[model samples]
Target chain A: MTGQVRTVDGRVAGRRGQETRQKLLDCLREMLSTSPYRDVKVIDVARMAGTSPATFYQYFPDVEGAVLEIAEEMAKDSDTLKELVAGKSWAGKSGPTTSEELVDGFLAFWRKNDAILRVVTLGAAEGDKRFFKIRMTVLNSVAKPLAEAVKELQAKGQADKSLDPNAVSGALVSLLASAAEHQKAFTSWGVKVKDLKPNLAPLVYLGVTGKKAPK
Target chain B: MTGQVRTVDGRVAGRRGQETRQKLLDCLREMLSTSPYRDVKVIDVARMAGTSPATFYQYFPDVEGAVLEIAEEMAKDSDTLKELVAGKSWAGKSGPTTSEELVDGFLAFWRKNDAILRVVTLGAAEGDKRFFKIRMTVLNSVAKPLAEAVKELQAKGQADKSLDPNAVSGALVSLLASAAEHQKAFTSWGVKVKDLKPNLAPLVYLGVTGKKAPK
Candidate 1:
């Protein structure tokens, strides 16, 4: 049975290896809730997960590799996002986007995973190399749909056709990212997230639409 | 004199108090350059500064307070930033903002001070209440001139007159604050700060002129 398991390093394999891997990932997720990747200690994490340090070493070279793997797995499950965007395709393909549709999607995305994002983004900002790489991977995932909308509008001649879609995509990405930040701040100050949409909606709407929100 | 220097707590304020404070700031800043703010510890900072725990306790009520003071003080100095945006004022008014002027000031400012800004802004998302506050104060200070610029544009009717200068100001503030943040990551990657203006100038210019830079 022990021979059946292949060790990435000189550790036991198979079911035992799988268990150790899950244990490390679970411990990592908990730390991700409250701290960035670099700040977490491998020994502390292993101990918390009830694994030995040697066991942890067998699966992951370090904390960053563990986190990057977990985050990538989580982001791969985009059913919720797909469901949200699917119902609202922004006018079957044209003209300025309604403020409600664009703004509401952004607000909902933040509320769903504020803690996870705050942690992952902070980890990526530092030189947690693997974590940083996946962080951009997740960003590009979000940017994909946004790029589609920009392209859709350009095809219909409503969006700025000549603008670099990449640049506009970056602006939209940064805007929503900041909105997530502002929402968190508002929540901290006891203001509700729902309340912020009214203030934040029009800024993005106008920037993208090049006009006022329709009543 | 000692009484005057003492904090509200019973800790004595003397030459030692000042030295302890300076040491913490210096150590924290150095650590933050190579590491994220959330990853740094008060003990690590105190140890590097060669100060005892008792000495650190005598100065700051907590680590956050010490870090806040350093970043806040950095924000207060306008010589560098003033020079950065000074002649770069809105386009219609006159002279093209010299690449030399813009690049020099931006390079000088970040090359010298990015450590603190990185700590202050990046730490905000980590739920550090002190860094969050310092981030806001630093942002507000940077936003002042941009606010003045928006008002000037609105007055000229070059930009949207109906745009709430305050909201536009807030949006603009968030933009640069976010830029400064990405700038830190860019700097860490060996990208030159002087080279950043080629990318940045167009963003600011697009923002003021209501025209996206030619793709």
Candidate 2:
């Protein structure tokens, strides 16, 4: 369980302290969305929040630490992604519907938190374990249940037994993440924005069902 | 036709100038691999190359500009990825072979240029048009040909005609790119490094051929 939110000095945060910490976090989020992560300094974040760098450090260790806090908040929100896949039926007409909803929900979540997710991705790529764990939390929110669904279907011989459920689910989730991350790339490919969900849903259904979606 | 390489000052570079410029780029590439892109400065690159910041600016405008140069060179090298899909047969046993080779070659290319590609991905995500264009040049090197292969298969009644070839091909390539970019994610999922190609090749084959890969 998450213990009480505390300051860098290990003091429990009161209501006022919490409010100020939240304010700094909001401003930091704004800066991350507008500028490259590399240019985001503690001083700039403090200036944006109308606070001194000393105050900023009173709450968090550094820019990466503050960013991790934001990422942790996003990962908590990512639990909402669970409903998109958990207990979803992948049978007959219902499979394609489940796929469509999952695609829409996933893409929307990504677009909402893209800036922070971008930094998380970069940090993970840079061999940062904290970022990697945070990213896995988000990805696993959907991937874990999705893999179970695949395993269930394969056991019933509804899906391809040859495919590894974890890899299939992981690849499908990665495909969704990639599509969400690079929606612009699809546009340049002449795949319209309106075409993304329609196009991606069937692929997800195919990956899950090992057959074309019900027409 | 290709144009001659020139310095930032609008002067054609002689052999020595080109060598110096090339050295700076090489050093920049090294710097990028070792450090975060945002922290990569002209001074550091010049120091690494045993040159001056003036010489660095003499050939490029800024860190991003120099990164673009390295990316462009890598894009040129991406031309080799075209052969992985161009005119490749996707019928029966050959389909899985093509898939394996494509996965292998794509993963190799991504690993070789992982550092700069990471920056390019971040820039494109940040809506930098120059980086987006450069990223497309590399993706299109593979995506375009793979799209054509899918179209051919769909035309011949081999693949699911209901699916959009461009979208399907784009998704598969994105999956590969994602897999390459985050190979660590798979490892953390208990997927071994050696397990990647075997697992991904079938998915690629399935996406293109719309059938279970022939064993």
Best by TM-score: 2
Residue A172 error, candidate 2, Å: 0.8
Model 2 residue A153 lDDT score: 99
lDDT per residue (tens digit) for residues A1-215 in model 2: 88999999999999998988999999999999998787888998888888899999999988889999999999999999999999899988888999999999999999999999999999998888999999999999999999999999999989888778888888899999999999999998999988999989988888888886767
TM-score, first chain, each model: 0.74, 0.96
> How accurate locally, in lDDT, is each candidate?
0.59, 0.91
Q: Give model 2's docking category.
A: medium
Name the 10 consecutive residues with the lowest summed lDDT in model 2 chain A. A206-215
Q: For all the models shown, what interface RMSD does each have?
A: 5.4, 1.1
Q: What is the lDDT of residue B96 in candidate 2?
A: 87
Which tens-of-lDDT digit does each residue in B55-119 have in candidate 2? Answer: 99999988888889889888899999999999889987788899999999999999999999999
Q: How many backbone clashes does candidate 1 have?
A: 0
Name the runs in model 2 displaced over 4 angstroms.
A9-13
lDDT (Cα, tens digit) per residue for candidate 1, span A51-153? 7888787887766567666766756653345443332444422323444555577557655666566656666656566556555554555555666666676
Residue-level error in angstroms, candidate 1, position B85: 9.3
Writing each residue's lDDT as its tens digit, candidate 1 over B1-215 gives 22354653765567867766777778877888877666677788889998776667667776667777777777667434644544455653331353234434544565577667665655677667766776655555444565567678778877766545555555544555454455434443334555455544444454444554443
TM-score of each: 0.68, 0.95
